[model samples]
Target: VERRIFTSKMWSLWRYGILLIIMVTPSHQQELSSQVLLDNISRIVDSRLAILDMRMNNIGSQLNDVANQDEKLMVRLSNNLEDKLAELEKKLLYNLEVKLSAIEEKFPNNLEERLSAIEDKLPTNLEEKLSAIEDKLPTNLEEKLSAIEDKLPTNLEEKLSAIEDKLPTNLEEKLSAIEDKLPTNLEEKLSAIEDKLPTNLEEKLSAIEDKLPTNLEENLSAIEDKLPTNLEEKLSAIEDKLPTNLEEKLSAIEDKLPTNLEENLSVIEEKLLSHMEENINQEDRIQGVNEMKMNIESMEENIIAAMNRSSVLLQKAGSTRCPEAEGFFMSSGLSRQCFKFFMDIERSWDSAVSKCLAEGLVLAEPYDPVMVKNYIATKYGMTGWTWINGRGSGSYITWQRSEGHIMSDIPYWYSGQPGSSTSSSHCLLLMTRQYHMKNYPTQAFYANTCTSKYYTLCELLME
Candidate 1:
């Protein structure tokens, strides 16, 4: 590479020297000198290129030697070559810059532009070579070098500090002045929030102060009565769910309260406030809530009975019914126990049963047909059907009853009734007060599809 560079420099200098000679030559010798100079320059270029070809041949031989080496040695050799090539590239760039600078210094006005142009073109290859070097650098080494560069202070902090030092110390005062320039209402709103801070805190503190003594006594008594077995057990189970210091603080307060009730109450109040703030999260609290719900559900029967009895006396005469045999006997004429007729509400047979069950009742059972017929015809002002708790299943039709076999023996069908082909229409309903030409009884029962929505009649069996 050095030999090639030397040859290139020699060729440039020789050409320049020849041009200078030609310029200084007498006019009569100029043409001959120019022709001779051209031929000499051509011969020099050919010889230099031939030398370069020979050097390339030597380089090829070295490459073949490198290729025949062991893998580890080849790797080491390749790494060394890369390092040397990078150094060479750096030296070349430096030399080129120095030469350009020297040329500019010698002919500042005439050659500065030319020097700059050369400098600009020099970077095209340099950049590509530098990229190759960077690609060959060890990944860890590159990362560490990048980290070092980052760590090297860029004076940003110093500049920021200088800028900050130039700023006025009375910046807050200036801000307050700007705030004062705001509209009066906005300022007033902000002032109101600021002014209420103390009052709000004072109110909260006063509330806590007022409740402290009572709460302390109550908590102490509660701890004594509830703590030993139940609370302690529960505390153990849910210790992780509570604040770590809560049980300890409670125990401490409990121990101190008896001897120093008034004195320690303030401490207890503070602890209690903190404890209240650090409530068990919803997930933990929900566990206890679920347990309580299950307990409440277990007493659902008793609760429903209580609710029913609570509302029983409030019902007007003839509306309330007494438990009689398999059903309730209402003064309104044999309304079944737990049976309620809803004029406005209509539901399918299944839904009607569910609705009744939800209200501690079931759908009305048509046990006493004459009584049911009398109740239905009298009560309803319309001719719509009322669902009853009678369903036909296969050959053995059944009706809902508390006891005793179904009243299948009864001959209460309206003419061609129970409809022999009523495979799908099995649910029974009472047809009330119809005014058709056939003169069929208004209190007739019919077999209809169970899914049909009609006026619901619900029965509530008395406990």
Candidate 2:
């Protein structure tokens, strides 16, 4: 049995992490940028506040001098003396505060809120804080703390205690212990580096891929050679394992063993593993993917995901679920809903409709107007048709038109045309006909205009 290492939880985690990371790190300047910018703003506010303090002191002295002056002289020399002085003092203080705030605004840190929260949670007692901190220290840091013991003065214990009292209660002791335990070695320092992902990981990965050794043409040939070589090794293994009725055993597996690969590798897995590295462990991914493909159960799971997103509503005619939106089935990362290949054809409607149903899709629906248009463009580029499910029921044509859309204006046959109920107008033809004296043709052309013969256009429904 082939080994399968990948689990669903691992897949879920990877997908969930990727989506969460997009929200957190978005646009690659990445998460730390806003925090760094916020820090700079706080730094600027500190500098501005320092300058304002000195200027405010100077203003205080000038205001005292103004107050001492006689009211008569003050009023004669200045207007609204009391109010003006108050206003000047208020403006100076307010302006100073605003500049300091400007710096605070630049920082991502809301220092006031964080400090308030920390204060509320801080441990009150010095002994408990100190004891807690000491308890969390690693054994190696015990020696380091002992070295600093004498440096801490007995009389200064209260000051150290005060600082500890202000420390956040939850991690205060642990953090102090961590600080004491920090390695003195230059190579080791407290850092969040392990938590940080490289900003250039993707680019670096791409760069590595570019640098990887791959032969221009010879590598493909080597890979092809390796395929049969692997087959030989597996055959040898079977030979070694078979019981001693060698002749009968060899005959039983001889024709079947080589073909087992097809059973082991699903078409999807085969497609996925077609891309593998040329290095020593390249077969690891190849085998894993190959095994995943082999599991029809997984493919069915993927198909369900495809079905969920499929627009082809399975109306158990009376069933109560309004169909899910059509575009979703093919949208999943692992599922591909449809593939179209245009065969060179010269056939009638009956044959075409049968051909489509055989492929497990209906005549192309006018849904996915854009995909239909492109498909038609590539297939005939100029034209295509879809069969309508209008027989026995009213005319509800859902053919793949040029743009996966039915033109808003239904074709009004020339005054005398489309009057025939039977054979003459049975077939729908994209052939040229005069409309209002101008030549008009449908995108999909059929040789005959007899409507009874069923023609097929691309229509998609769920598997």
Candidate 3:
């Protein structure tokens, strides 16, 4: 192999080198002078160019032959390649087609032949037989029947022909007569349904079972429950013809019950409401509400008066009040509670209170009964209330305005008891209701009620 390669390389070099030498040796030299030799070399170069063009044409022809031979390889590789091509085609089909088969398929052979093949697969007997039945249907019914006929299973044509022979003549007139005579009496309708009891009802019901809604069986079962003792055997005989489960049949029976029951129930509710309104006096209820409000306000004023006296005593106690902050008010405040910000966060309740004190608010303490009532009203609006430790008598819980120390004074426990749940919802909160404590807003999951041990709001004479 080594010798063969070396010999081949040398031979190629020799062949090319000789051709080059021949081209360089003047091909058209006439007089052996400098100018003539140059002219001869130019002629030789032209000859070499012609040969190069011929060689290139031969290489191109060879390449075309090689490409033709590769066509066989394409077929062998087609297993994987065809699958990839089909995948691409399916994607394209999905993009373009509302129904893919219509886009993906190609018609083969004659259109009439294809149509004939398809028809051959269908139930020949039924299609031909349906003509007589179709003649009996209403105009609109005929059209709908034709549309449905196209979709049924292939054997339908034969079965339909057999059924056609069994049907009564004058079908259209009979249907119209039946529609016009729809039962004026309940007993008549029930009797009609029983009289028409088909001999092949079991087979018919079995065929229809898959199409019936689940409620049908349930309705039938319920009818069984209400059936009179005298009619038990008769009803059971009919029930045995049903195809569905007991529950579904009972449901179907109830659904078919007369509409009179619904109308009667509506009439009863309206009558009851009319009677209730006639028995009650509207004026008495209004008078009771106004009296309760007047009493509460009077009690509230008395408590406020006492708080003023306590404020005077605190002044006399010589506790130096710091200069009032920007929003500070020594007197009663506007009704709305405002939000405040504290820069520092602390771990413990006592530390939080100290932080609030530094910021010029007190752990809120209510001074008077009105204050207690107001606080009660406020906490109800909030999720819960916790007693922030502060100074106050039963009359009022007052926030020491200078720094957070004084707390609101209010004692409120639900009339019955405290309820701690599975997670030990131990602490009590006074969730302030929207209309004082009367309207309770349901708490959201994340609304943590204030606890005594938790960080709480400080009432400030705000800056």
Candidate 4:
């Protein structure tokens, strides 16, 4: 029985060794040919058999154990040793076959062919044989297998845990490196796009700018070309009217100037123009013209200031003084009496009245056209707007000289005169100046805004 067990163990070990040599040998090794693998397996099996034979010979050579022991005890001890060796051999062969079978299946190529060859070499009744051997196995087989099973799961768990820990750390480090690179790559891409966009936009904008002025000039030229003849004529007419308007304003300014300043300015202007037309020394003429222009400008400003003077001191016009007639006092028809109307300065309504009162004279109360004409005749050339004492009180018109004595008739009003509906038009003024055409008669009365500054009219009885 021990011999049969030993033979079976050696057969199993030989099969296991053949499978391991074929399956576990590296393909790159020079000694890895099929013949070499088979030779190696045979050598391993022969070596194991020789070791077992040597061990058996050593046991046999132990004559002292045989001589010292009783025959029965020696046979019993030999049986025990054989049983122990067989048990060990059985476990080793079973474990080797299992591990070698696993490795053999992992061979990627010629698996079917190799398995067929192995099957031809193997016993045909291998399963039946293994079943018979298992039935006769020791009762401790299950316990031994269970111990191996228990040791395998714990070792596998520890190995898996170690692998698991190392794998995640390496994976996390790689992922971190990848993540770090991503933002830099994205930022570089974005910066490149940002750099390109503005340059492209600037190029486009420059192209537009280059085209704009030409387009604008063309459009303007087209519009100008399309303008109607009447529009051009209208512009020409306005241009023609500019000089006339300017002359009229100058004439008005001249009228406002004092008589002496007006005469002096007129003489200087005429002389300058004559010198230019006669082709005088151009530099001298220019210098003279510039000097004269400065003088005229200064005089014009002074004259305007004098004409528009409203805040005047009345203490200079004394109470005992009387209006001078300039020897033209008339006590004849159309007037009870008339004295010279002299006004060199402008004043407000109150100031004008106070000034006249200081002169012991009254503001003229001309209610009819005959009185107005008579009064105007006293100063024939008196022109421009001037203030009279006619004022409105509630619904009644009254003169300052004859308060409460309302006038019976409205003599003459300029086109939109009186303007009595307006609160500002509370006083009366004589619009003596004409513009463009003479519409109103000379010294025509007009209702005016009271706040305006104007020359005052004073009257006194000629005795």
Candidate 5:
């Protein structure tokens, strides 16, 4: 029974060794002809068996050492060694099972299902689905734009004709009427005034010359004769009348003066100095007041001149009108500029600019983007992206058709806008859609690619 058990144990060990050898073999070697693969496996098995025989010989030597001891002690050592070998075999089997399970999980069980899923996600299938959805969308915007273009020209022509009828047809006749209202003898009246000016000035000068005295030298001589000549003799006579003890009298007056005279003099001097300072301050105040008056007068003159210029400008604005053309309208703001919105067609930034230039106009620049936004919203009810006359260089954006930089502080830009000039998108676009959750104003500016097509805005300045 022990020999049978030993044979079964050896068979199990041999099977495990063959399985391990097969698992560790290279894939290319395994793909060899069946007979060649079996030969390689047999050689590996023979080598492993030789090593096993050596290990068995070592075990026999260990057993011989145990044979010198008591029989019960030898049996106990043999059982312990069997138990350790069994534990190692179980551990090796567990590790092999774990590795096999991991490899099995890596590959899918159904190859057909995996291939079908990848095929469904291809580009051609996606394109077909997108085209079907696009066909269902409405064509309302195109119809509306077409209708507007068809009717715009006729309405504009009629309005222009009516305005032309109201304007003065004969400007020469009107000028002649104005000339008739002026005085006929205006030249003669100016000449008479000029004649009187020189004659009046000459007569006045001659009359003054005649009134002057001729004996001026004789009168001066007469006055000199009447004046006193003995001034020194008179002074000597007055000195003789002075008292003999005049110095003594002065000395007595000085002795009777107050003891604090020096102090009093100092106090009086300080008071005089303070009074002088006060006077100087008053003078400064007067001078400042005079200067302020002069400034006020100059300001008043400037204000008057500005008012006169503004009145003239207002009159000119009222008389002038924008050219009668389709798509052109006057600005609602004080600028009163003529603007045209080309909504029916789309063009690139450069192409749009060229079209405007060909038509004797320039691409519209929104110096006050808010005003332009409000005007478009109220007038045409338009809300879409369009190109303006703005371009960027580095961090700075400037109007392509006008002077001055487009300031970043202005609220015209959409959030996180005005991308770097070196980037592909550096041209300016007016975005009329709300892209973010925050409620930003419409017609906000966006940095966009120059090659992208969009509707254009053109400006016409009427002199």
Candidate 6:
């Protein structure tokens, strides 16, 4: 009875401890403590301990399997990453070699040869040409001016005399005859006749004299009325017969002859002498030619400096290290972004986007469309329609990557782009040189249906 009581007390304590463990342990793990206490409590405890040990062994083996699987997965992933890195490194090295060779070819080592070639292209007969021009120029401006002045007055007098001779000779003759026929002593003769006359005879003669004076006035008026009425008209007709553009010629001559002729002539002589001196001075001419040559050489040096700066910039930007194995090429201009053309692979807009994403790139978003066009022209020559990153309906377009609103003011679209059919056209397409056919500007944008299949253009962002 004492042994049984002692066993019962131990069992009760063990039950309480198990309950405490159950309360503290997680619900998933609490199922392991399911063995019940019996009258043979020692045997029951041993059996329960064996079952717990076996379950713990099973759990550890399962944990080991999971750890092995995880390690294998990590190892496979690492190997894949390493392979990709090695491939990328090889491609980069190959691309670098190719770029270095191209640079070497484009810009040779011997600058002296280039300088000599440039010198050969320069004009050699500059001094000779200048001398020939100087010889052809007028030297005796003063003598020429004086000669013109001397001939001017004589020509004018001769022309005036010829015009005077053209006037009527009968006019002068008529005037002289009228003067001769007029009575200079008519009043004196009349007075003498009046004195000789008797009183009645004198009165009658006075009346006759008054009547004769009235008759003489009427006769003079009649004679004046019978004279030439068209004298001014005849003179006008003679003036008209002189020349077709006679007045214009005279005005031009007047304009050519300066009002201050002597002062103008002296000024012209000074200017001519100065100009001749400048041209005739062989040393100065040679110096000017040398200066021009030096200027050209300086310009060449500036060009070379600019090229070196550009090369340095290219190195800094990593533009020369484009991923050529992936068919990517560097764009021209300051952006220096890399691009790839998948001409053979035609896909819908969505499919194209997927393809670009898979390649760790995005659809081409050509902010500088002109530079993009030039790059395409230089490398590809010509191409068919291709996909870009623009997507929208109507005038409200946006870049797929940046989601920035497309500015309509930019001249990136073709003549009739973003077409009227907005319902069907919701994606952007690049119009190529082949599509333009030299008619429209190449690489212009055009709206097309999202489902339409076209060549893809992908852009790899710069780090």
**Largest lDDT belongs to which candidate?**
6
Worst 10 residues of 4 by lDDT: 308-317
Cα deviation in Å at residue 41, candidate 5? 99
lDDT of 5 by residue, 154-194 (tens): 44666577546554545445545544544454455454544
Q: 32-141, model 3: which lDDT tens digit per residue?
A: 44455456655655565666667778888999998987986777788779899999999887877756655545444366875785576445476654785466445566
Cand. 5 TM to true fold = 0.31
RMSD in Å for model 3: 30.7
Q: Clash pairs of candidate 4?
A: none
TM-score of each: 0.27, 0.20, 0.21, 0.26, 0.31, 0.31
- Against the true structure, candidate 3 reaches a TM-score of 0.21
> What are the per-residue Cα lDDT tens digits for candidate 2 across 147-174?
4574444545665675466544445445
Per-residue error for 245 in candidate 6, Å, reads: 72
lDDT of 2 at 180: 48
Candidate 5 stretches with Cα past 4 Å from truth are 1-316, 377-383, 421-425, 433-438
User: Which ranges of candidate 4 are over 4 A from the true structure?
Assistant: 1-324, 327-332, 367-380, 404-409, 422-425, 434-438
User: Model 1: which ten-residue window has the lowest total lDDT?
Assistant: 402-411
Q: Decide which is better by lDDT, 3 or 5.
A: 5
How far is 348's C-alpha from truth in model 1 (Å)?
A: 1.2
274-327: candidate 6 lDDT, tens digit per residue: 644454354433332322333432333233333333334434553346687756
- Candidate 2 stretches with Cα past 4 Å from truth are 1-75, 79-82, 88-333, 338-340, 346-360, 363-460
2 versus 6: better lDDT goes to = 6
Pick by TM-score: 3 or 6, better one? 6
Sort the predicted structures by lDDT, highest score first: 6, 5, 1, 4, 3, 2
Residue 462 displacement (Å), model 3? 11
Better of 4 and 5 by TM-score: 5
Count of backbone collisions in candidate 6: 0
**Regions more than 4 Å wrong, model 6:** 1-316, 381-383, 420-425, 435-437
